[model samples]
Target: MHESPITGNGDVVKARQAVRVLAQEARLSLVDQTKLVTAASELARNTLSYGGGGTMRASIVTRGTSTGVKVVFSDQGPGIPDLDLALTDGWSSGRGMGLGLSGARRLADEFTLDSAPGKGTTVSVLKWAR
Candidate 1:
């Protein structure tokens, strides 16, 4: 796994680029690569803006005969108190359109979210190669 710090805007860009590279290396199609990169970008931005900075881990994953790229974004900031509402479309806790989490989920093959009120948040996304 490769870990990139999401301390600022530059770090978010770095994280997205890293994910793109990993997706490419995984032999994902061009369209899949774009989707993963876009999802990574959204999550990275959320990590910086909402989570108050965090780390993004990118790696290749395999299950059964399938291979894919996985990215995990984790932060130690105020956790989402209403995950259900947060996942709803057109919801925004900040100035954004609030499409980050839900949009990322739509783009990935698998998505998982973990957060607690006083703890933090972790979002994992995986896109299988096709």
Candidate 2:
């Protein structure tokens, strides 16, 4: 298993690179690759745009003797006051199409978000090799 935690503006780019590499190595479908990449990109942007910039971690997970890609994005910003609202389409705290979380959710095979007001936000996603 490999672990990486991204921090700062440039870290997001690195996170994207990591995602691309994992997607390629995992031999995921082109459609799944596109979705995963786009999800990572959007999540990375959210970390920068919302959080004071955050962290992204990637690792190879072997569970039940199966291979998978696991990524986690976290931020220590204002934090999401209403997770339900944040996850809704066309709902945003900024000038976005409100698709960040929603879109990311649509792309990932597994997605989870943990957030609280004044605490911060963390999002995790996983894609499997099929």
Each prediction's whole-model lDDT (CA): 0.93, 0.81
Score every model by TM-score: 0.98, 0.88
Best by TM-score: 1
**Candidate 2 residue-wise lDDT at 121:** 93
Q: After superposition, how far is residue 120 of candidate 2 from its true place, in Å?
A: 0.7
- Cα-based lDDT at residue 130, candidate 1: 83
lDDT of 2 at 75: 81
Give lDDT tens digits, candidate 1, residues 46-98.
99889999999999999998899999999999999999998999988885789
lDDT of 2 at 71: 79
- Report lDDT (Cα) of residue 103, candidate 2: 91
Worst 10 residues of 2 by lDDT: 1-10
Q: On a 0 to 100 scale, what is the lDDT of residue 46 in model 2?
A: 87
